[model samples]
Target: MDCTTVSLPFEMPADACNVHLHIIDPAFPNDGKAASQIGTVETYQALVNKLRLPRAVFVQAKPFALDNACLLDAIQKFGPDNARGIAVVNNTISDQGLEQLHNGGVRGLRFSVWNPDNAVVSFDDCAPLSERVKHLDWNMQLHMGAAQLVKWADIIRRLDCKVVIDHMGRLDPALGVKDPAYPFIQEMIDKGNTWVKLSGPYLNTKTGEPWEDATRTAVAIAEFAPERVVWGSDFPHVTEKIKPDEVVLTEMIATWLPTKKARQLALADNPKELYGFV
Candidate 1:
């Protein structure tokens, strides 16, 4: 069941980078809670080696809240060239501290508005936080479902910095194309001010594996605006019962892309641009 030990089923262009992955460490102080608790930095490095991608972005785990010590530690170990970090922050984070995070290879701040249990930053907080980091040329990453996206579309439109929306935009299966969020997400992709991750189909799927309904959204977006889409493994997949085989994930992404060059672009070039990787 371990992705780190499984052989890659499909060949990935070596130049590609993984845009989403979490390194959860339970040792960090939380509100008496534990993180997803995956293997350590060395173990993650092993998964990276198996995948054969040198660049990755480590998203702060939900359990860790604002304490990014484990995340910071990994960034230092991986060095700025190979790793970028997405962090969580409260309203009080100082400008100097932000500069330090940037210097240490952190490129973006993340907020969660969907999962109420793990939610730290509220919608009211996004504006000021967006304003604060707008000057850093950093994006504001969000882990929210489609309903949340549509509900907050007005303000999201006004963000000074770009936005990176997670998990194939995670539209509800029942909504289909008629979903209001679909068009808005399309608009963001069309406007070139937003990017979405083609990751974690299992979480939002009803039919499973290939995620047929989710595919409807992802494929359409890829065809509509290939450049605005990127791929991620969401590795060591936290809190799910049916563990995903990385090979299946890779194959599924390939099908969504449907061409060698398209896969290459989504897997490598697009991520390099969004993540600032050389």
Candidate 2:
């Protein structure tokens, strides 16, 4: 079997913007053979070259699965100045640890109720996490579905820190852009304390390839919150067999969000504002 893989379109230059963050995942696969071969410095360097060696590459550390020690080690080798990070945390992340992560250039925390393995942070827990982050002025990025929209809408409204919805609030494709749940996302955007990432078609698409099913939803989000909308290439898609190639996904995004100004906002400018990239 061929181990070779297809890479994204090379037409675009790497100096596209201030370091395009890779949102790195540090968790090595459990399978020893695969783990030893990939997830190394050489592997990451190759991947970065493939990404056109973004000006600054920030990786979302594998907070839930890996120890902070391992994360720090990776940063030391990965050019700390050229990188930044996001972490997973709940009430348990000690005050000291959070402060340290802040110093390390981690500007936000991601909480996902969608993953079965991760514990959901309840409202009681969320309030304090919101409080903790408020001091640092870091935002909270959340992942959820239609079922949790009402709950999240209220939670974000009350929270002090800005909230970013991952994967366009991870909408269900069956709902399309007109879903009542989508309005809640729009409402949050309208409220002016929220941002949404135009990433991960699998989260919103019902069928395979050419995930246009998500276009209307993305467009609606762009329409509702153009200033707050940003795009990400959820690279090395974990645990999904139907993974999207980066080039194709980028092209799809370009198609869905046509217009030079929209592309600049979605691809470069908006992310800088939300993520604080200079």
TM-score of each model, in listed order: 0.91, 0.80
In terms of lDDT, model 1 sits at: 0.78
Model 2 over residues 21-93: C-alpha lDDT tens digits? Answer: 3333335332232342224444455555655434332434343242344445455566665454656666888
Give stretches of model 2 more than 4 Å off.
Answer: 1-48, 51-63, 69-78, 120-124
Off by over 4 Å in 1: 1-11, 31-36
RMSD of 2: 4.4
| Clashing residue pairs for model 2 | 19-55, 19-56, 24-59
Looking at model 2, report the run of 10 residues with the lowest lDDT sum: 14-23
Enumerate residue pairs that collide in model 1: none
Give the Å error, residue 109, model 2.
0.9
Cα distance off (Å), candidate 1, residue 81? 0.8
Q: At residue 205, give the lDDT of candidate 1.
A: 74
Candidate 1 lDDT over 150-227, as tens digits, reads 888998898988799988777886665567788998888777779988887776678876678777777877887888
- Please tell me which predicted candidate would have the highest lDDT against the true structure: 1
